[model samples]
Target chain A: MATDDAGESLAEVGEFAVIERLVAGRRQPDAVAVGPGDDAAVLRAADGRTVVSTDMLVQDRHFRLDWSTPHQVGRKSIAQNAADVEAMGARATAFVVAFGAPADTSADLALELADGMWHEAGLLGAGIIGGDLVSAPQWVISVTVLGDLDGREPVRRTGARPGDTVAVCGELGRSAAGYALWHNGIERFDGLLGRHLVPEPPYGQGRVAADAGATAMTDVSDGLLADLGHIADGSGVGIGLRTDALSADRDALAEAAAALDVDPMAWVLGGGEDHALVATFPQAPPNGWTPIGRVLDGPPRVLVDDAAWQGNPGWQSFD
Target chain B: MATDDAGESLAEVGEFAVIERLVAGRRQPDAVAVGPGDDAAVLRAADGRTVVSTDMLVQDRHFRLDWSTPHQVGRKSIAQNAADVEAMGARATAFVVAFGAPADTSADLALELADGMWHEAGLLGAGIIGGDLVSAPQWVISVTVLGDLDGREPVRRTGARPGDTVAVCGELGRSAAGYALWHNGIERFDGLLGRHLVPEPPYGQGRVAADAGATAMTDVSDGLLADLGHIADGSGVGIGLRTDALSADRDALAEAAAALDVDPMAWVLGGGEDHALVATFPQAPPNGWTPIGRVLDGPPRVLVDDAAWQGNPGWQSFD
Candidate 1:
């Protein structure tokens, strides 16, 4: 189980021994009563409710080993899943990861992946309680995040009614722009490309939005327009956006857009994976939140500047 | 979202539309307050605790598309994760699945997989509360199960003492024997080969074992010897198996073993993936459980008939 003797494949080390190395010297959080090395992990949910979500990332589809290190993939996996918990107006307490990779993969790479997961979990004060490791043709990671509601009513998507102000926090269009840069083989936008690899979700902002009495909340994963459509469709209310209000976000991506000869507004409107927190507030949103739209009295639809702006709505997995 | 079109691929149907088809017509259990349609699902956990576990399955590695139906793979995925919950002395309430597969895959196959999961979950009175669908090079399914303990204490591996009787419920060595039959192209044992595709764990036996005062328990995911060795190492006790008590299991695999020209006892003692429940009871195990071994005071090791048995210990992911 020792990493001192290197250059062995995972199959040579065996599953149990590799597991021993993956699990060694890691500290579990207080919420985990029975951590890994058990049949199942026991996590305390004092509020009598557990917010759960899952996301699977396949190699080359969700990430590229050539573009990002195993550590970044690990962080991105946890961060994206954690963003879901945050969108639910809950704080993630623990995660159980299931990883599949080729047998010849280095144990050190797996360790670095775990290290990345631990680092991301630490940022949110959570732990990786349990996991399953398996062999696959390519790297596949599935993360399930368990979140605590802290005795608050889960801010569901159905709660956004007429006249609620739509607000967002954290970066927008950054990940999409970063992807564009990396895809185009541009090297000038170091920060944008890095952001695409490892996103910085506005941690704890979910709790703050919840405490501020936000009615409905979700994270921007499938672009602003597409994700807001979820709230619109779920709440059965139309949302109208002010293009002027999103100028700041458009400006943030302007340089990258110019370099790519693309419309910056398109990135701001249709880019995904920034993991920014977007919510609907019956009153003024909390500090550091930007108001961009308002829930309207109409059919379930999203409008840009009181009109339909026809562009690429957002990302879809099969596309 | 409707799957009215008979021959559309996942890419043609699209991710959101495919997800809608997969989730359609499924009734969630009472424990799910909010199911699907949001960033996360909220499950009721009135016990102030939730038991969690996860497992991942990859195509051509964990399962073969030619050998097993998509439905069988789905059942196997859920059944194994449910077994982990059952091992914790908890009743599985909800499951969240993350699935990845090729874009050109048939959408109906995806529905069949969901149907299989729902059918298996119905066996435990649980629900497939939420799921995510994405594109991958091959099929990768990850399932996270959430369970409620119903106020009973979790039977952990560290609680087995020197004198506790090791008892087991459900079939053993069937999957391994079945794997051998399939590998050798022997089609004589229908039951064994079918079992290799979908394991039937003693559905409610974890709670039964707990009610009968089981001190420690685990599922036989790996070989019984390897999993029991985990208990031995965790509890600081040795496990001594009575081969006489395992004659029934060996006999069950004898026909398959004879066809493969292998030892049936080796399969019974060292096979895994049957997902049978193995527990340590201070007294007699509950009715319907078979006594197979005893705990002893010594270093952590597994002995067969008071002596070391040289054989394959169990299945490991890497190996």
Candidate 2:
């Protein structure tokens, strides 16, 4: 009874009509000079340069529709892409998404996904400027985010210098713990489970780090140690984590770790998808940042308490 | 022997290692100020404003893997996105692609796909700057193109007037004809079949139209009639085509249409995906353009010889 008697699918609605439904009534931020329905959208890059990054999330691999709602998938997609833009010490201006799903997919679900994207983008004062939708065998969401540096120099991962303090703003490892719980069918940690469904990226803190004279910055999409390793490699320096500084993060996940029979430290150091902002600063960090380590003289490596971590490094696409 | 390899899938390669392998040893163009391995790529947008557009191609819906090689699909994906930039009277400067494919997909096929993308991008002197790769149930390629207007005003679809001459550059209806042939299992037309796989967008002609004082412009991704209808509706005018002027295009496809027992005029008028540059100019058309119609007083519609067309209108995403 829920199905259309005419058996209409996405192809039946047509690309333009589907687009009309997807774009109708969506509010755009001021930065978007033009939105969808044009050949291309025009965005104002206030800083004379636009920071751009892209990420693709596939069903079952990045997310399982059986576990996450369409709204959650939409949020996760935008959140991850926004985190990449934030890592550059810039404020996201607009996003263009390309989504592919089966023709048989419920139109209501698709609308819900758009709602979720708009919801997440609203957090950063950004807009969904343009997008493309097509039918595929499964859901594939690819998002590209454009950011404005606001006249400041973009923070690169290679700028960290010896003696600079490494600090982070936002919670870490909750998503990974949630993922484990979900995989093992343990549903005790509701918050952790929700965190896995939709990550809460540290909003506005990237610009905060830049204004505070941060030398380098990145988001912890990969595990903390693995992401820091990227900074070490790019900056050609060593990074040493002070476990005492991370005790709070570990303690936050202690219960979930206990339930899973895994070390909370492993979740803190080796888990990923938390999207926390980490930066290296020459002076004291910004108001919301917590100092966790120090950038060291080269040999490009990440160490836990001055010793190499022996646990799993992090996630891999091929794996 | 394959079993001895542990039948490694994307899960076995992991995300990072697979990415490392995919990114290894690919030459990047000079326009890529910053390439892959960064949080985001940095490209020099010489002009103050950047024209951006995105398109997503989903397997089975957009292209059948059985009908198209990965290389052809890659080329088609880039060609269509580039056409959008061209439609804006801008030259594509760089592209960021996000590709999702199954884990069991051969690495060689992924390489070939990238190789084809590079091949097409080279034609425009543009660079493939950054991308994201993830595992999906099917092949989904999303491409976002950035273009530079070179200080020229963008020729939007809203600018045409009643007296403007409607003209087009490049072929039309060939892709539709090809699709029909492929669908009907008519194997004789190799050129048409190949054209369907990789469209030859009228590159650089958008600027030509702009320089010729064109009022409105768009690419013929949809059928000519449907595309012109968009220009008509946007510009608050109607468009009337001269059948005699389109004879050349029809003649070129006549033989194939005859073989398939279809009307060549239908293909020429309603076919899509030729990516021909269609624009309205005030006076004599530009050097490379061929005049085909004229803008008329509105109630926005497209007509052929002052009569409504009875053929298929064009392709749509949902249908």
Give candidate 2's TM-score.
0.94
lDDT of 2 by residue, B280-310 (tens): 9999998989999999996899989999999
Per-residue lDDT of A80 in model 1: 98
Model 2 CA deviation exceeding 4 Å by range: A1-12, B1-14, B21-31
Instruction: Give one digit per residue, the lDDT tens place, for model 1 in B78-191.
Output: 999999999989999999999998888889989989999999999999999888898888888999999999999998998999999999999899999988888889888899
Q: Count the backbone clashes (under 3 Å) in each candidate.
A: 0, 16
What is the per-residue lDDT of model 1 for residues A53-139, given as tens digits with 9 covering 90 to 100?
A: 999988888899889888899999999999999998899999999999888888888888999999999999999999999999888
Model 2 residue A211 lDDT? 92
Overlapping backbone residue pairs in candidate 2 total: 16
Cand. 1 Cα-lDDT: 0.91
TM-score of chain A of each: 0.97, 0.96
Clashing residue pairs, backbone N/CA/C < 3 A, model 1:
none
